[model samples]
Target: MAPQLTSLYTTSFLIALFVTLLVAACLRAINILPGRTCHSAKAPRKAAPATRILIVLGSGGHTHEMFHLLRDLDTSRYTQRTYIVSGGDAFSAQRAVEFEQTLEDRASETRNKATTVRRRGTERPLCVGAEHFNIATIPRARKIHQSLLTTPFTSLVTLVSAFSPLFRSDRLHPNLPPTTPYEIAAQDLPDLIITNGPATGVIVVLAALIAKFFNLKGCSSRSKCRTIYVESFARVKTLSLSAKLLAGVVDRFLVQWEELEGEGGYVGGHAEYWGILV
Candidate 1:
């Protein structure tokens, strides 16, 4: 009886091994295995049609990282568009002109080397004015302070009135326009990628909501809509809790800080640790 039991166990082990080999062989035959996705596990897959990629970045090292990604994008599969909306020297009109020229030069070099011609350009995004304040201008600041001190309610009323047109919660509201940042960006874009800044993330979220509103599923207009958030812990750590919450809505989260690269703060579970861009 013992001999028979040992033989049975050996037979079961052999059968399981054969089944595993057979399943692996079948997967390899159909090119469903990881190594077979690309030819010989080393060669790259055939490039997909050009995708529309939007890089929404604040002006700083984060912006610099997006520029590097723009330069390296597989032109055969991606065309990059950039939107600048953050406040800094980089977001100023002068910097916008300089950055535009630099991006154009990079795009030209990329297009010359590949069959996929990239149609790239920059957009100066519209401001929501939610957090707009002018502290640098002393006269305006003094006036605002005087108003606040004299009549707090009046100041509050004035501020709300000033920003009334910018904030809309409902899609069907008559004041809200159907044309959103995503719709506007995706009009000529196949894929959209946004990086840095909570404001840019807001633009992407608005775009995705607009895409769903139009029912653009499965089409090119819907197919390439993707937002990649290039995150820096330095930046994330600096933001208020509400701003961090807002940043969580992006599609892909890529980290730049090497020491604190894993999922934390705003990124949560969907974060990818890319270490440093440079």
Candidate 2:
């Protein structure tokens, strides 16, 4: 009789587990259906639009190094670029503009030289890439050893600002077309988000990841909002606080040094030691 009772209990537990799993699966399917449907209908786009790229700048060396990286990028490919800088960072904004101008000037020089060499007006048009990059600012989330009492409030505000640009697109891009009712749904989330370690980056990245999770605006692909986190060149042996925190969410965690590879304690994917990016 005891053995029979045990058998009955096991059978009941299995049934309950199966029901729970079935319900959960159904709910998941319902939630994912909308994104999947839209993705399928729009996928295999005949001609993919230019990728919208966002680069988060953390003042000082972060800005300088990234400037070189951006300058070298193929502007024709990444047509829409957004630069996120922490508030009160006038230098970064200025630098971004300068970077743009530098490319333009160089392009002109190259074009003229080509024209001169060709002995006619057969030179190709300028290939200025930096002009595509746009800049926006967010307040810093924390200071080194910031007081715990006030950290939460600042962090909260910073996080909001990271997502705040959604409501006001014109303010960022004055030339943008008139927004429509579907503006909110069809908003352009960055196709690619790239950043290096800085306390401020943590918030911006976190916001992007959350938006991706919900299949919200600006995510080009329903299944992913590609984020790449490059460890600071300064840290050759260890990951910084921001890098470590962002390891799980970033689609790619790039290490500048060979030794630091696989140190993130995350199996999200193999950490690539791409050597120096700057």
Candidate 3:
């Protein structure tokens, strides 16, 4: 009878602890998640001298669409670009390099065409160089034809690996202090994170959430790592799995179709439609 009572008490204590942890997680999520209304129009409280942007690229279609969405990206404003791709995804890495080359070429052409000496503050210089961008590879959350029963283990691995790129690594400049703008950007949290519906995208965003929840590197306090998720143009009626999962968490959830707007019953309200971006 004593043993039975001890078991019961132990079970009750575990249950109580579980409930406490669940409540704490919920409160933290609420505090960090973005609100329903879009705040992109508002000016930032304090702008950094150099801005860094992290872009997550997926395989095939997702990668194709992401570049299209960023076709008009102003390299001058986003001074540094970090491209994150899953391991063994050479195509995406190559694409990122090609994109940077294009930016560099465009900058060169603009400089050649300029007839007058540019005055200070009139226009920012183009951030076009190999020094301004980097490509990082992380393990895939799940491989093709992988068993679902073991997925949680692999996803956890992916989540843990995702945080490395989010934080500034000292390995970037091991021997010397960062002096240039590009070097400084490399050692700071990204100002923005952009992704489309990819398996790895969800994991990266979840990692960002965890960092913000703990205020890792002052992510939340500095208002850095703001995320934007764009739904695929093909999803006309319903949200994609990644879109649904991220609707409440990302700073902006944009759908190409009008039908998908207001679809997700998120605590932050509804998804937004800004026409077909891709």
The lDDT per prediction is 0.42, 0.66, 0.86
* TM-score of every model versus the real structure: 0.44, 0.70, 0.88
Q: What TM-score should be assigned to candidate 3?
A: 0.88
Q: Please report the TM-score between candidate 2 and the true structure.
A: 0.70
Q: What's model 3's lDDT at 177? A: 86
Model 2 worst lDDT run, 10 consecutive residues: 31-40
Best by TM-score: 3
Write model 3 residue lDDT over 1-278, tens digit each, in one string. Answer: 35766665687789998999999988987888886555665476644557999999999899999999998888888888889999999999999999899889988888887756665665777888867888989999999999999999999999998888889633455788899877888888898999998999999999999889999999999888999999989898878889989888888888999888777746634688889997
lDDT winner among the candidates?
3
- lDDT at 187 for candidate 2? 41
lDDT of 2 by residue, 142-258 (tens): 766889999999999999998864323223334675353223222466666778877777787778766754557534245434677888788887778888887765667778888
User: Model 3, which residues run further than 4 Å from truth?
Assistant: 1-22, 38-42, 45-47, 116-120, 169-173
How many residue-pair clashes does candidate 3 contain?
A: 0
Q: Candidate 1 — which residues are off by over 4 angstroms?
A: 1-48, 59-65, 68-71, 74-76, 80-100, 103-186, 213-221, 233-243, 246-248, 258-268
